[model samples]
Target: MPSTPSIPPWDVHRPPPGHGKVFLITGGNAGIGYFIAEQLSAAGATVVLGSRNPAKAEAATASIRARVPGAQVRTVRLDLADLPSLRTAVEPLGAERLDGVIHNAGVALDDPPREETREGHELMFATNHLGHFALTHWLMPLLSAAPAARVVTVGSFAAKTERLDPDDLQSRKEYVPKRAYGRSKLAQMYFGLELDRRLRAAGSAVASVVVHPGGALDSLTPSRPPVHVRTAGARLRGAPAALLVQGKDAGAWPAVRAVLDPDVRGGELWGPRVFGLRGRPRRERVWTHLTDASAATRLWDASRDLTGVDPGRLP
Candidate 1:
């Protein structure tokens, strides 16, 4: 394992002005994704808020504009669970050049019985890892075209406790919801790191960085009318529990760091500076599984085979 130095403190509110940059954030309709989009658009970036539902995305965009007057925000329908939905969702971005893309959409957890995506992969794996993989391949050129573009993937602390069975990448033999979720997150981090290495080797200016939002809860978010989030969320966030957990906006700091921090290098993994669950962004190491070069390569190859799309054209 290579040693990595700790990162400096990051203030998510202090992102550099993004007047000329164009950013795309998947799952921007709610949760940390929405907050990230809010912060980015407030910073003056022309942000493409990608969501599975057009109405929800529009609602989020309106909320952003209401909060940050004159913000440049557009909605794009992106469904990570469906490949066809991804294609239709990405059509609008074909002509708009992007300076950065954040793969932030994913299923946090699900009950057992391991469901399969439309593409016939494990549901968690398909949404959390493969969807981002295929999306990246689709946008590689536009990314490479921009000078020093970045790809920031939102990973999770679940990676630390999980083990990936490379042989059964799809969880066919066994399936536990949390374990499956953790494996998917680990795969995301692995893919991001491997992409960084590949882009660097190819002498491409694009950088791939992965980050995890600490224990962020939806309860901390202000109510978005018409959508009833788990009401229990607000209760769970009460009293001392609130201190340990971070709000959705604060949880987005690591990803915000990955997106805007100029000093951040490719292949770096960043998360909360305090206990890996709260505070400003700090550099961290993921499980050795994510650092295993061979495993990453296998995942990358498998991704291309499944998606039938090659990201090789970028370099």
Candidate 2:
């Protein structure tokens, strides 16, 4: 019998080549998502950028290929805000088994009275949490087929200060934009943790791990040309913030680690190394609020009802 290849020592700068592995990153065309896709592609992974816009996805793919010669990259039209579209989103993946999925896409409405999706769910909650929930369900079979696939959920630091009103998951009664956005991300964290619990109970091969990009600011991010252009003035302006917070590229580390790190287990939360805001990816203690099993279960149930996809109904 042949021994399995041993993983190389972990290096945040130069991750071990993914070779035959395939990874799907939601919103991989921009922000931290683009960096995740770029980094993973640089490491030889076949990266699929899930985006709502085809043209944007193409540009991201081109940028990645330009940066990393011979990079394997592609795009799929994925609109997380539209729940009906999710049911068929994975059909184009065309892989026998999916190695990992980084749930990196999200929406944050700054000034809003509050918005709802066409399905009438709150926009932020629909896109951030429930969309990924349904997509995960659709991707389960492909995920299950892998030797030890990982599902990485990118949460938010904004969630630290907010709590989900389980009864008002949609924020129908009183809708504050920032609070609603935070709550939506908090819901995603809950989904990630709860998914792990169910996966453990089911004896499944896939792992669900949660991660947060701490204080990822655009000004702090280095330029990625057409995708992102950080002017010198922008960099100078960002220098002060850079002391405590990191750029989007650095912000992408936790999720990338969650997906590629062999030792990373289900039910773990990872973030930045320096005060959970900057530097390398480090394992952080899960917040107490996030450990509410009752809330998690309730959110899971509500998500299933809302998304019309039960992740537990694994293929």
Candidate 3:
């Protein structure tokens, strides 16, 4: 809300009851997303953990409920890699007036060959940006139905160093894993900031904000049975790599704050206070490209053309 907003974590950090509020999180099956689900559910909110696998979603919901007795949580199958899957995943959630939707599902292609989505876009772009664009577009009504709502877009530190090449979004020309990942994340921030401008122009009550969870470590974070399982890399728990990364619980703070913090404002970017690594949430300086209206418009137009969908009348 201010040039420099002050955020004091309440719901997620203090475990204050969220009571009647309904929030949906993509990729809630594991990683940082699951911790957000647990934090919100522990605070008494009804959380819908969206994942591609029903089994995994059930495990996540069960994990939260087990930890917080009588916690209200459910699961929905959502696959961000495919557009049709996202459409089907949102159907059941449309009936309720949602308090927030955290776009946290993402994929990082490390030294892997360039891949494409079912829709024919770059794998990272589709999963990280396009799918979320389509999801938010389709769910606008339910968002509008709420007295006031928020859309928390989980972004990455990559945005600061990388910019999207509107001329070639797919990286078909030349694929570099890190650059491709950065483009997708930058596009995500563009959407979040642009959506806020559009919502304000149309007199909508919903707000959109972008946040980056500091480097989140799957192995270093606390493990909950039947949900979080250790990987081979996890065996090196106290290694430098693990030590540098924050646990999933701390990493989930920025997004959770965007959804619950009263002081957070639309169109603002927030990240961990400690150099995008591990710390409490704070108002982080945004990349210059994110402030460009023309760039945002270009991203918005291209996203619509690629998805062949709209966020309904809200636009």
Measured by lDDT, the strongest candidate is 2
Q: Candidate 2: how many backbone clashes?
A: 0
lDDT of each: 0.82, 0.93, 0.84
lDDT of 3 by residue, 1-315 (tens): 467776544544674457899999999988889999998887788899988889989888878988989998888888888887666677887456889999999998899688987678899999999999999987888899888899999988777888778799889998999999988988888899898888988899999999988787776778787787666567475457654567788899888878877778988998887777878888877768789999899889988888888663483
lDDT of 1: 0.82
For residue 87, what is the lDDT in candidate 2? 83
State, as a TM-score between 0 and 1, how close model 1 is to the true structure.
0.91
lDDT of 1 by residue, 43-73 (tens): 8888998888898888888888888999999
Better of 1 and 2 by TM-score: 2
Which residue pairs collide, candidate 2? none
Model 2: lowest-lDDT 10 consecutive positions: 7-16
Q: Ten consecutive residues with minimal summed lDDT in candidate 1?
A: 221-230
In model 1, what are the clashing residue pairs, if there are any? none
Position 174, candidate 1: lDDT: 85
TM-score of 2: 0.96
Tell me the TM-score of each prediction against the true structure: 0.91, 0.96, 0.91
The digit string of per-residue lDDT tens for model 2 on 1-315 reads: 999999665689987679999999999999999999999998899999999999999999999999999999999999999999988889999899999999999999999778889999999999999999999999999999999999999999999999988789999988999999999999999999999989989999899999999999999998888999999999999899988999999999998889888889999999998988898998999999998999999999999988888997778
In model 1, the runs with Cα more than 4 Å from the true position are 1-9, 84-88, 94-96, 224-237
